[model samples]
Target: MIRIETPLTDETVERLRAGDRVLISGVIYTARDAAHKRMVEALQRGEPPPFDLKGQIIYYVGPTPPKPGQVIGSAGPTTAIRMDKYVEPLLKLGLKGMIGKGYRSPQVKELLVKYKAVYFAAVGGVAVLLAKAIKSSEVIAYEDLGTEAIRRLIVEDFPVIVANDIYGGDIFEEGRRRFARIDL
Candidate 1:
Protein backbone atom coordinates (compact mmCIF):
# COMPACT_ATOMS: atom_id res chain seq x y z
CA MET A 1 0.00 0.00 0.00
CA ILE A 2 1.31 3.45 -0.88
CA ARG A 3 1.53 5.92 1.99
CA ILE A 4 0.99 9.64 1.53
CA GLU A 5 0.78 12.62 3.83
CA THR A 6 -1.79 15.41 3.99
CA PRO A 7 -1.09 18.90 2.57
CA LEU A 8 -0.26 17.06 -0.64
CA THR A 9 2.20 18.62 -3.05
CA ASP A 10 1.74 18.82 -6.80
CA GLU A 11 4.38 16.17 -7.29
CA THR A 12 2.62 13.85 -4.90
CA VAL A 13 -0.78 14.35 -6.55
CA GLU A 14 0.69 13.89 -10.00
CA ARG A 15 2.31 10.65 -8.95
CA LEU A 16 -0.96 9.13 -7.79
CA ARG A 17 -3.09 7.22 -10.32
CA ALA A 18 -6.65 6.02 -10.22
CA GLY A 19 -7.04 2.68 -8.39
CA ASP A 20 -3.99 3.25 -6.24
CA ARG A 21 -4.48 2.34 -2.59
CA VAL A 22 -3.16 4.99 -0.27
CA LEU A 23 -2.85 5.53 3.45
CA ILE A 24 -2.81 9.22 4.29
CA SER A 25 -1.27 10.67 7.42
CA GLY A 26 -1.29 14.14 8.98
CA VAL A 27 -3.99 16.80 8.98
CA ILE A 28 -7.18 16.76 6.91
CA TYR A 29 -10.31 18.86 7.07
CA THR A 30 -13.90 17.63 7.18
CA ALA A 31 -16.82 19.37 5.49
CA ARG A 32 -20.07 18.41 3.85
CA ASP A 33 -22.75 20.32 1.94
CA ALA A 34 -23.64 23.03 4.46
CA ALA A 35 -20.07 23.92 5.37
CA HIS A 36 -19.10 23.91 1.73
CA LYS A 37 -21.80 26.41 0.88
CA ARG A 38 -20.70 28.71 3.68
CA MET A 39 -17.07 28.49 2.59
CA VAL A 40 -17.94 29.35 -1.00
CA GLU A 41 -20.03 32.25 0.21
CA ALA A 42 -17.16 33.50 2.31
CA LEU A 43 -14.86 33.34 -0.70
CA GLN A 44 -17.37 35.23 -2.84
CA ARG A 45 -17.49 37.96 -0.22
CA GLY A 46 -13.67 38.29 -0.29
CA GLU A 47 -13.38 36.83 3.18
CA PRO A 48 -10.77 34.24 4.03
CA PRO A 49 -11.86 30.65 4.58
CA PRO A 50 -11.93 29.38 8.14
CA PHE A 51 -8.91 27.29 7.22
CA ASP A 52 -6.29 27.77 4.55
CA LEU A 53 -7.04 25.97 1.29
CA LYS A 54 -3.54 25.65 -0.04
CA GLY A 55 -2.47 22.03 -0.42
CA GLN A 56 -5.14 20.83 1.96
CA ILE A 57 -7.28 17.71 1.84
CA ILE A 58 -11.01 17.90 2.60
CA TYR A 59 -12.95 14.80 3.54
CA TYR A 60 -16.63 14.85 2.66
CA VAL A 61 -18.07 13.61 5.92
CA GLY A 62 -20.56 14.49 8.63
CA PRO A 63 -19.53 12.28 11.51
CA THR A 64 -21.70 11.13 14.40
CA PRO A 65 -20.99 12.20 17.99
CA PRO A 66 -18.19 10.30 19.65
CA LYS A 67 -18.92 7.57 22.16
CA PRO A 68 -16.53 8.09 25.11
CA GLY A 69 -12.80 8.81 25.02
CA GLN A 70 -12.73 8.89 21.25
CA VAL A 71 -11.19 11.66 19.19
CA ILE A 72 -13.93 11.50 16.60
CA GLY A 73 -17.16 9.63 16.06
CA SER A 74 -18.26 7.33 13.26
CA ALA A 75 -16.47 9.03 10.35
CA GLY A 76 -17.55 7.80 6.96
CA PRO A 77 -17.23 9.34 3.53
CA THR A 78 -20.23 11.13 2.09
CA THR A 79 -21.34 11.20 -1.52
CA ALA A 80 -18.95 13.43 -3.47
CA ILE A 81 -21.05 14.44 -6.49
CA ARG A 82 -23.15 16.67 -4.26
CA MET A 83 -20.18 18.98 -3.79
CA ASP A 84 -19.44 19.38 -7.49
CA LYS A 85 -20.66 22.98 -7.63
CA TYR A 86 -18.25 24.06 -4.88
CA VAL A 87 -15.21 22.09 -6.07
CA GLU A 88 -13.86 24.30 -8.82
CA PRO A 89 -13.51 27.35 -6.63
CA LEU A 90 -11.74 25.34 -3.94
CA LEU A 91 -9.47 23.77 -6.54
CA LYS A 92 -8.57 27.23 -7.82
CA LEU A 93 -7.37 27.99 -4.31
CA GLY A 94 -4.87 25.10 -4.45
CA LEU A 95 -6.82 22.40 -2.63
CA LYS A 96 -4.90 19.23 -3.47
CA GLY A 97 -6.94 16.26 -2.43
CA MET A 98 -10.51 15.16 -1.61
CA ILE A 99 -11.87 12.06 0.13
CA GLY A 100 -15.36 10.72 -0.32
CA LYS A 101 -17.41 8.03 -2.03
CA GLY A 102 -18.85 7.55 -5.55
CA TYR A 103 -18.15 9.14 -8.90
CA ARG A 104 -17.84 12.87 -9.51
CA SER A 105 -19.36 14.89 -12.34
CA PRO A 106 -17.50 15.18 -15.63
CA GLN A 107 -16.77 18.85 -15.00
CA VAL A 108 -15.34 18.08 -11.59
CA LYS A 109 -13.22 15.29 -13.07
CA GLU A 110 -11.91 17.71 -15.68
CA LEU A 111 -11.06 20.24 -13.03
CA LEU A 112 -9.27 17.58 -11.04
CA VAL A 113 -6.86 17.12 -13.94
CA LYS A 114 -6.65 20.83 -14.61
CA TYR A 115 -5.85 21.62 -10.99
CA LYS A 116 -3.42 18.74 -10.42
CA ALA A 117 -5.51 17.27 -7.65
CA VAL A 118 -6.83 13.82 -6.86
CA TYR A 119 -10.02 12.38 -5.40
CA PHE A 120 -10.00 9.47 -2.99
CA ALA A 121 -12.73 7.07 -1.89
CA ALA A 122 -13.07 5.64 1.54
CA VAL A 123 -15.34 2.63 1.73
CA GLY A 124 -18.86 3.60 2.70
CA GLY A 125 -20.56 2.16 5.84
CA VAL A 126 -17.30 1.79 7.70
CA ALA A 127 -17.61 4.83 9.91
CA VAL A 128 -16.64 3.29 13.16
CA LEU A 129 -13.52 1.76 11.69
CA LEU A 130 -12.62 5.02 9.98
CA ALA A 131 -12.86 7.07 13.15
CA LYS A 132 -10.07 5.08 14.68
CA ALA A 133 -7.61 6.74 12.36
CA ILE A 134 -8.46 10.23 13.55
CA LYS A 135 -6.05 11.37 16.23
CA SER A 136 -7.84 14.63 17.03
CA SER A 137 -10.71 16.76 15.78
CA GLU A 138 -11.82 20.35 16.37
CA VAL A 139 -14.53 22.44 14.80
CA ILE A 140 -13.08 25.22 12.72
CA ALA A 141 -16.27 26.81 11.40
CA TYR A 142 -20.03 26.48 10.91
CA GLU A 143 -20.65 25.04 14.33
CA ASP A 144 -24.39 25.49 13.93
CA LEU A 145 -24.27 22.86 11.22
CA GLY A 146 -23.49 20.22 13.87
CA THR A 147 -22.04 17.11 12.21
CA GLU A 148 -21.79 19.16 9.02
CA ALA A 149 -19.42 21.60 10.69
CA ILE A 150 -15.98 22.15 9.20
CA ARG A 151 -13.46 20.34 11.34
CA ARG A 152 -9.71 20.15 11.42
CA LEU A 153 -8.68 16.52 11.87
CA ILE A 154 -5.31 15.07 12.58
CA VAL A 155 -5.25 11.58 11.14
CA GLU A 156 -2.70 8.81 10.99
CA ASP A 157 -2.70 6.18 8.23
CA PHE A 158 -6.22 6.95 7.15
CA PRO A 159 -7.00 4.58 4.29
CA VAL A 160 -8.44 5.52 0.91
CA ILE A 161 -8.34 4.70 -2.80
CA VAL A 162 -7.55 7.06 -5.63
CA ALA A 163 -10.92 7.40 -7.31
CA ASN A 164 -9.92 10.13 -9.74
CA ASP A 165 -6.35 10.99 -10.62
CA ILE A 166 -4.72 14.09 -12.02
CA TYR A 167 -4.23 12.29 -15.33
CA GLY A 168 -8.01 12.18 -15.81
CA GLY A 169 -8.34 8.54 -14.92
CA ASP A 170 -11.47 7.40 -13.06
CA ILE A 171 -11.88 4.18 -11.13
CA PHE A 172 -15.65 4.05 -11.57
CA GLU A 173 -15.44 3.98 -15.35
CA GLU A 174 -12.73 1.37 -15.24
CA GLY A 175 -14.78 -0.77 -12.93
CA ARG A 176 -17.77 -0.51 -15.24
CA ARG A 177 -15.69 -1.50 -18.23
CA ARG A 178 -14.23 -4.44 -16.38
CA PHE A 179 -17.67 -5.64 -15.41
CA ALA A 180 -18.90 -5.28 -18.98
CA ARG A 181 -16.04 -7.42 -20.19
CA ILE A 182 -17.13 -10.26 -17.94
CA ASP A 183 -19.17 -12.72 -20.03
CA LEU A 184 -22.14 -12.74 -17.70
Candidate 2:
Protein backbone atom coordinates (compact mmCIF):
# COMPACT_ATOMS: atom_id res chain seq x y z
CA MET A 1 0.00 0.00 0.00
CA ILE A 2 1.24 3.49 -0.73
CA ARG A 3 1.61 5.55 2.44
CA ILE A 4 0.88 9.26 2.29
CA GLU A 5 0.39 12.03 4.83
CA THR A 6 -1.51 15.32 4.80
CA PRO A 7 -0.36 18.62 3.29
CA LEU A 8 0.12 16.54 0.20
CA THR A 9 3.04 17.86 -1.82
CA ASP A 10 3.04 18.11 -5.62
CA GLU A 11 5.78 15.49 -5.89
CA THR A 12 3.72 12.99 -3.92
CA VAL A 13 0.68 13.70 -6.06
CA GLU A 14 2.64 13.23 -9.28
CA ARG A 15 3.62 9.71 -8.27
CA LEU A 16 0.13 8.56 -7.32
CA ARG A 17 -1.96 6.69 -9.83
CA ALA A 18 -5.51 5.42 -9.93
CA GLY A 19 -6.14 2.08 -8.22
CA ASP A 20 -3.27 2.60 -5.79
CA ARG A 21 -4.05 1.38 -2.28
CA VAL A 22 -3.20 4.00 0.29
CA LEU A 23 -2.87 4.44 4.02
CA ILE A 24 -3.25 8.09 4.88
CA SER A 25 -1.94 9.75 8.04
CA GLY A 26 -1.80 13.20 9.64
CA VAL A 27 -4.45 15.90 9.31
CA ILE A 28 -7.56 16.00 7.11
CA TYR A 29 -10.74 18.00 7.08
CA THR A 30 -14.41 16.97 6.91
CA ALA A 31 -17.14 18.67 4.96
CA ARG A 32 -20.48 17.38 3.88
CA ASP A 33 -22.86 19.16 1.45
CA ALA A 34 -23.70 22.05 3.74
CA ALA A 35 -20.18 22.86 4.71
CA HIS A 36 -19.12 22.65 1.10
CA LYS A 37 -21.80 25.10 0.07
CA ARG A 38 -20.73 27.53 2.74
CA MET A 39 -17.12 27.21 1.73
CA VAL A 40 -17.93 27.78 -1.91
CA GLU A 41 -19.96 30.83 -1.04
CA ALA A 42 -17.09 32.15 1.04
CA LEU A 43 -14.80 31.81 -1.91
CA GLN A 44 -17.29 33.61 -4.12
CA ARG A 45 -17.42 36.45 -1.60
CA GLY A 46 -13.64 36.61 -1.46
CA GLU A 47 -13.68 35.66 2.21
CA PRO A 48 -11.00 33.49 3.71
CA PRO A 49 -11.62 29.78 4.05
CA PRO A 50 -12.25 28.50 7.56
CA PHE A 51 -9.08 26.48 7.51
CA ASP A 52 -5.78 26.73 5.70
CA LEU A 53 -6.28 24.68 2.55
CA LYS A 54 -2.72 24.56 1.24
CA GLY A 55 -1.95 21.02 0.18
CA GLN A 56 -4.63 19.75 2.56
CA ILE A 57 -6.96 16.81 2.19
CA ILE A 58 -10.71 16.97 2.63
CA TYR A 59 -12.86 13.96 3.38
CA TYR A 60 -16.52 13.98 2.43
CA VAL A 61 -18.12 12.76 5.63
CA GLY A 62 -20.74 13.62 8.17
CA PRO A 63 -19.71 11.80 11.31
CA THR A 64 -22.20 10.75 13.95
CA PRO A 65 -21.96 11.76 17.60
CA PRO A 66 -19.23 9.90 19.39
CA LYS A 67 -19.76 7.58 22.30
CA PRO A 68 -18.26 8.71 25.62
CA GLY A 69 -14.61 7.93 24.94
CA GLN A 70 -14.27 7.96 21.20
CA VAL A 71 -12.99 10.93 19.23
CA ILE A 72 -15.60 10.51 16.51
CA GLY A 73 -18.50 8.21 15.75
CA SER A 74 -19.15 6.11 12.67
CA ALA A 75 -17.29 8.04 9.98
CA GLY A 76 -18.20 6.94 6.51
CA PRO A 77 -17.44 8.55 3.18
CA THR A 78 -20.42 10.21 1.57
CA THR A 79 -21.18 10.26 -2.16
CA ALA A 80 -18.48 12.50 -3.60
CA ILE A 81 -20.63 13.86 -6.41
CA ARG A 82 -22.49 16.05 -3.96
CA MET A 83 -19.41 18.11 -3.40
CA ASP A 84 -18.38 18.25 -7.05
CA LYS A 85 -19.53 21.77 -7.79
CA TYR A 86 -17.70 23.18 -4.81
CA VAL A 87 -14.41 21.55 -5.67
CA GLU A 88 -12.81 24.05 -8.04
CA PRO A 89 -12.77 26.78 -5.43
CA LEU A 90 -11.01 24.54 -2.97
CA LEU A 91 -8.66 23.29 -5.66
CA LYS A 92 -7.75 26.86 -6.44
CA LEU A 93 -6.76 27.28 -2.82
CA GLY A 94 -4.17 24.47 -3.19
CA LEU A 95 -6.29 21.65 -1.84
CA LYS A 96 -4.52 18.53 -3.02
CA GLY A 97 -6.42 15.46 -1.95
CA MET A 98 -9.97 14.25 -1.40
CA ILE A 99 -11.46 11.06 0.07
CA GLY A 100 -15.00 9.89 -0.43
CA LYS A 101 -17.18 7.37 -2.29
CA GLY A 102 -18.66 7.45 -5.83
CA TYR A 103 -17.15 8.41 -9.14
CA ARG A 104 -16.20 11.93 -10.00
CA SER A 105 -17.60 13.71 -13.03
CA PRO A 106 -15.38 13.84 -16.10
CA GLN A 107 -14.90 17.55 -15.63
CA VAL A 108 -13.76 16.99 -12.10
CA LYS A 109 -11.37 14.29 -13.24
CA GLU A 110 -9.83 16.79 -15.65
CA LEU A 111 -9.62 19.30 -12.86
CA LEU A 112 -7.61 16.84 -10.79
CA VAL A 113 -5.07 16.59 -13.56
CA LYS A 114 -5.06 20.33 -14.06
CA TYR A 115 -4.47 20.94 -10.36
CA LYS A 116 -2.06 18.10 -9.76
CA ALA A 117 -4.36 16.63 -7.14
CA VAL A 118 -5.96 13.26 -6.45
CA TYR A 119 -9.27 11.80 -5.31
CA PHE A 120 -9.62 8.65 -3.25
CA ALA A 121 -12.38 6.26 -2.33
CA ALA A 122 -12.95 5.04 1.19
CA VAL A 123 -14.92 1.83 1.22
CA GLY A 124 -18.55 2.06 2.10
CA GLY A 125 -20.29 -0.08 4.75
CA VAL A 126 -17.27 0.35 7.02
CA ALA A 127 -18.22 3.37 9.02
CA VAL A 128 -17.34 1.96 12.42
CA LEU A 129 -14.07 0.59 11.16
CA LEU A 130 -13.14 3.92 9.59
CA ALA A 131 -13.75 5.87 12.78
CA LYS A 132 -10.93 4.00 14.49
CA ALA A 133 -8.39 5.76 12.30
CA ILE A 134 -9.45 9.17 13.50
CA LYS A 135 -7.15 10.03 16.40
CA SER A 136 -8.80 13.37 17.03
CA SER A 137 -11.71 15.48 15.71
CA GLU A 138 -12.95 18.98 16.31
CA VAL A 139 -15.55 21.16 14.63
CA ILE A 140 -13.57 23.88 12.90
CA ALA A 141 -16.39 25.52 10.98
CA TYR A 142 -20.13 25.45 10.27
CA GLU A 143 -20.86 24.04 13.71
CA ASP A 144 -24.50 24.97 13.30
CA LEU A 145 -24.73 22.42 10.53
CA GLY A 146 -24.41 19.69 13.18
CA THR A 147 -23.23 16.45 11.68
CA GLU A 148 -22.63 18.23 8.38
CA ALA A 149 -20.30 20.71 10.02
CA ILE A 150 -16.71 21.07 8.87
CA ARG A 151 -14.26 19.31 11.13
CA ARG A 152 -10.50 19.12 11.39
CA LEU A 153 -9.36 15.56 11.97
CA ILE A 154 -6.08 14.00 12.98
CA VAL A 155 -5.96 10.55 11.46
CA GLU A 156 -3.63 7.62 11.72
CA ASP A 157 -3.40 5.13 8.88
CA PHE A 158 -6.70 5.68 7.14
CA PRO A 159 -7.30 3.26 4.29
CA VAL A 160 -8.37 4.47 0.85
CA ILE A 161 -8.08 3.67 -2.86
CA VAL A 162 -6.98 6.28 -5.35
CA ALA A 163 -10.03 6.78 -7.57
CA ASN A 164 -8.62 9.66 -9.60
CA ASP A 165 -5.03 10.69 -10.13
CA ILE A 166 -3.25 13.68 -11.59
CA TYR A 167 -2.30 11.59 -14.60
CA GLY A 168 -5.99 11.44 -15.64
CA GLY A 169 -6.42 7.97 -14.21
CA ASP A 170 -9.89 7.01 -13.08
CA ILE A 171 -10.30 3.74 -11.25
CA PHE A 172 -14.02 3.56 -11.89
CA GLU A 173 -13.55 3.77 -15.61
CA GLU A 174 -10.69 1.28 -15.55
CA GLY A 175 -12.80 -1.14 -13.53
CA ARG A 176 -15.56 -0.90 -16.12
CA ARG A 177 -13.13 -1.58 -18.96
CA ARG A 178 -11.67 -4.54 -17.11
CA PHE A 179 -15.10 -5.99 -16.57
CA ALA A 180 -15.99 -5.51 -20.20
CA ARG A 181 -12.92 -7.45 -21.27
CA ILE A 182 -14.17 -10.42 -19.25
CA ASP A 183 -16.82 -11.98 -21.48
CA LEU A 184 -19.65 -13.37 -19.33
Candidate 3:
Protein backbone atom coordinates (compact mmCIF):
# COMPACT_ATOMS: atom_id res chain seq x y z
CA MET A 1 0.00 0.00 0.00
CA ILE A 2 1.16 3.49 -0.77
CA ARG A 3 0.89 5.88 2.17
CA ILE A 4 0.26 9.50 1.18
CA GLU A 5 0.43 12.41 3.55
CA THR A 6 -0.67 15.82 2.32
CA PRO A 7 -0.14 18.52 1.22
CA LEU A 8 0.37 16.37 -1.88
CA THR A 9 3.13 17.52 -4.22
CA ASP A 10 3.20 16.98 -7.97
CA GLU A 11 5.93 14.39 -7.54
CA THR A 12 3.84 12.52 -4.97
CA VAL A 13 0.77 12.63 -7.16
CA GLU A 14 2.71 11.44 -10.22
CA ARG A 15 4.00 8.40 -8.37
CA LEU A 16 0.48 7.07 -7.75
CA ARG A 17 -1.19 4.66 -10.14
CA ALA A 18 -4.76 3.44 -10.48
CA GLY A 19 -5.78 0.44 -8.36
CA ASP A 20 -3.17 0.97 -5.67
CA ARG A 21 -4.42 0.76 -2.11
CA VAL A 22 -3.56 3.87 -0.16
CA LEU A 23 -3.56 5.17 3.38
CA ILE A 24 -4.02 8.94 3.31
CA SER A 25 -3.11 11.08 6.28
CA GLY A 26 -3.26 14.78 7.08
CA VAL A 27 -5.98 17.34 6.46
CA ILE A 28 -8.78 16.81 3.92
CA TYR A 29 -11.85 18.91 3.47
CA THR A 30 -15.46 17.72 3.31
CA ALA A 31 -18.02 19.16 0.95
CA ARG A 32 -21.11 17.56 -0.47
CA ASP A 33 -23.48 18.81 -3.21
CA ALA A 34 -24.70 21.99 -1.58
CA ALA A 35 -21.31 23.13 -0.37
CA HIS A 36 -19.77 22.38 -3.75
CA LYS A 37 -22.44 24.35 -5.53
CA ARG A 38 -21.79 27.30 -3.32
CA MET A 39 -18.05 27.10 -3.88
CA VAL A 40 -18.38 27.06 -7.65
CA GLU A 41 -20.86 29.92 -7.51
CA ALA A 42 -18.46 31.92 -5.43
CA LEU A 43 -15.76 31.37 -8.02
CA GLN A 44 -18.13 32.41 -10.77
CA ARG A 45 -18.66 35.67 -8.95
CA GLY A 46 -14.89 36.18 -8.72
CA GLU A 47 -14.65 35.24 -5.08
CA PRO A 48 -12.08 32.96 -3.50
CA PRO A 49 -13.07 29.54 -2.19
CA PRO A 50 -13.78 29.18 1.51
CA PHE A 51 -10.43 27.53 2.04
CA ASP A 52 -7.02 27.65 0.39
CA LEU A 53 -7.39 24.80 -2.06
CA LYS A 54 -3.73 24.63 -3.02
CA GLY A 55 -2.25 21.17 -2.56
CA GLN A 56 -5.40 19.97 -0.80
CA ILE A 57 -7.65 16.97 -1.01
CA ILE A 58 -11.43 17.19 -0.82
CA TYR A 59 -13.44 14.26 0.51
CA TYR A 60 -16.99 14.09 -0.78
CA VAL A 61 -18.93 13.50 2.40
CA GLY A 62 -21.57 14.98 4.67
CA PRO A 63 -20.84 13.14 7.87
CA THR A 64 -23.50 12.36 10.44
CA PRO A 65 -23.28 14.35 13.64
CA PRO A 66 -20.94 12.83 16.15
CA LYS A 67 -22.52 10.76 18.87
CA PRO A 68 -21.62 11.89 22.39
CA GLY A 69 -17.98 10.83 22.52
CA GLN A 70 -17.07 10.52 18.85
CA VAL A 71 -15.06 12.78 16.55
CA ILE A 72 -17.46 12.04 13.71
CA GLY A 73 -20.04 9.44 12.67
CA SER A 74 -20.54 7.40 9.49
CA ALA A 75 -18.07 9.38 7.40
CA GLY A 76 -18.66 7.49 4.17
CA PRO A 77 -17.78 8.80 0.75
CA THR A 78 -20.51 10.27 -1.37
CA THR A 79 -21.01 9.58 -5.09
CA ALA A 80 -18.25 11.55 -6.81
CA ILE A 81 -20.09 12.20 -10.07
CA ARG A 82 -22.53 14.51 -8.36
CA MET A 83 -19.65 16.81 -7.66
CA ASP A 84 -18.06 16.49 -11.13
CA LYS A 85 -19.13 19.87 -12.40
CA TYR A 86 -17.52 21.50 -9.42
CA VAL A 87 -14.16 19.81 -9.85
CA GLU A 88 -12.20 21.71 -12.51
CA PRO A 89 -12.69 25.00 -10.77
CA LEU A 90 -11.17 23.60 -7.60
CA LEU A 91 -8.42 21.94 -9.62
CA LYS A 92 -7.61 25.28 -11.18
CA LEU A 93 -7.17 26.57 -7.66
CA GLY A 94 -4.59 23.79 -6.98
CA LEU A 95 -6.60 20.97 -5.42
CA LYS A 96 -4.79 17.68 -5.88
CA GLY A 97 -6.82 14.75 -4.63
CA MET A 98 -10.43 13.68 -4.15
CA ILE A 99 -11.94 10.81 -2.15
CA GLY A 100 -15.39 9.48 -2.89
CA LYS A 101 -17.35 6.48 -4.18
CA GLY A 102 -18.13 5.67 -7.84
CA TYR A 103 -16.43 6.49 -11.15
CA ARG A 104 -15.66 9.76 -12.83
CA SER A 105 -16.74 10.98 -16.26
CA PRO A 106 -14.36 10.87 -19.23
CA GLN A 107 -14.13 14.63 -19.21
CA VAL A 108 -13.26 14.56 -15.57
CA LYS A 109 -10.64 11.91 -16.22
CA GLU A 110 -9.04 14.10 -18.86
CA LEU A 111 -8.99 17.04 -16.50
CA LEU A 112 -7.14 14.99 -13.89
CA VAL A 113 -4.27 14.61 -16.31
CA LYS A 114 -4.35 18.18 -17.43
CA TYR A 115 -4.22 19.43 -13.88
CA LYS A 116 -2.24 16.67 -12.15
CA ALA A 117 -4.79 15.30 -9.73
CA VAL A 118 -6.09 11.92 -8.59
CA TYR A 119 -9.41 10.41 -7.56
CA PHE A 120 -9.74 7.93 -4.70
CA ALA A 121 -12.53 5.45 -4.03
CA ALA A 122 -13.48 5.01 -0.42
CA VAL A 123 -15.38 1.86 0.42
CA GLY A 124 -19.10 2.58 0.36
CA GLY A 125 -20.56 0.31 3.04
CA VAL A 126 -17.97 1.11 5.67
CA ALA A 127 -18.89 4.53 6.91
CA VAL A 128 -18.50 3.97 10.65
CA LEU A 129 -15.34 2.02 10.06
CA LEU A 130 -13.91 4.92 8.09
CA ALA A 131 -14.80 7.45 10.76
CA LYS A 132 -12.21 5.81 13.01
CA ALA A 133 -9.46 7.19 10.77
CA ILE A 134 -10.57 10.78 11.11
CA LYS A 135 -8.96 12.17 14.26
CA SER A 136 -10.97 15.38 14.22
CA SER A 137 -13.46 17.34 12.13
CA GLU A 138 -14.89 20.86 12.30
CA VAL A 139 -17.29 22.68 10.04
CA ILE A 140 -15.40 25.44 8.28
CA ALA A 141 -18.10 26.94 6.10
CA TYR A 142 -21.82 26.98 5.34
CA GLU A 143 -23.02 25.81 8.72
CA ASP A 144 -26.59 26.53 7.67
CA LEU A 145 -26.24 23.82 5.07
CA GLY A 146 -26.28 21.41 8.00
CA THR A 147 -24.80 18.02 7.16
CA GLU A 148 -23.62 19.35 3.81
CA ALA A 149 -21.48 22.02 5.42
CA ILE A 150 -17.82 22.19 4.46
CA ARG A 151 -15.68 20.54 7.12
CA ARG A 152 -11.99 20.40 7.76
CA LEU A 153 -10.89 16.89 8.74
CA ILE A 154 -7.61 15.74 10.10
CA VAL A 155 -7.24 12.06 9.23
CA GLU A 156 -4.77 9.31 9.99
CA ASP A 157 -4.30 6.30 7.78
CA PHE A 158 -7.53 6.92 5.92
CA PRO A 159 -8.04 3.96 3.60
CA VAL A 160 -8.86 4.34 -0.08
CA ILE A 161 -8.05 3.02 -3.57
CA VAL A 162 -6.70 5.07 -6.43
CA ALA A 163 -9.74 4.98 -8.69
CA ASN A 164 -8.40 7.34 -11.33
CA ASP A 165 -4.82 8.43 -11.82
CA ILE A 166 -3.52 11.26 -13.93
CA TYR A 167 -2.34 8.95 -16.68
CA GLY A 168 -5.92 7.99 -17.63
CA GLY A 169 -5.88 4.82 -15.54
CA ASP A 170 -9.23 3.87 -14.07
CA ILE A 171 -9.64 1.03 -11.59
CA PHE A 172 -13.37 0.67 -12.31
CA GLU A 173 -12.77 0.39 -16.04
CA GLU A 174 -9.89 -1.99 -15.53
CA GLY A 175 -12.03 -4.16 -13.27
CA ARG A 176 -14.76 -4.42 -15.86
CA ARG A 177 -12.17 -5.14 -18.56
CA ARG A 178 -10.45 -7.77 -16.46
CA PHE A 179 -13.57 -9.86 -15.88
CA ALA A 180 -15.92 -8.89 -18.67
CA ARG A 181 -14.77 -11.42 -21.20
CA ILE A 182 -12.42 -13.81 -19.42
CA ASP A 183 -10.63 -13.96 -22.75
CA LEU A 184 -7.27 -12.41 -21.97
User: What is the model-wide C-alpha lDDT for candidate 1?
Assistant: 0.94
Candidate 2 lDDT, 103-177, residue by residue in tens: 999889999999999999999999999999999999989899999999999999999999999988999999999
Q: How many clashing pairs in candidate 1?
A: 0
Query: Which parts of model 3 have CA positions greater than 4 angstroms off?
Result: none
What CA RMSD would you report for each candidate? 0.6, 0.6, 1.3
For candidate 1, give the lDDT of residue 48. 88
Encode model 1's per-residue lDDT on 1-184: one tens digit a residue. 8999878999899889999999999999999999999999999999988988999999999999988888888999999999999998899999999999999999999999899999999999889999999999999899999999999999999999999998989999999999999996
lDDT of 1 at 24: 96
Q: Write the per-residue lDDT of candidate 3 for residues 32-94, one digit (tens) a residue.
A: 999999999999999999999999999999899899999998999999999999999999999
> Which lDDT values do the candidates have, in the order given?
0.94, 0.95, 0.96
Give the higher-lDDT candidate: 2 or 3. Answer: 3
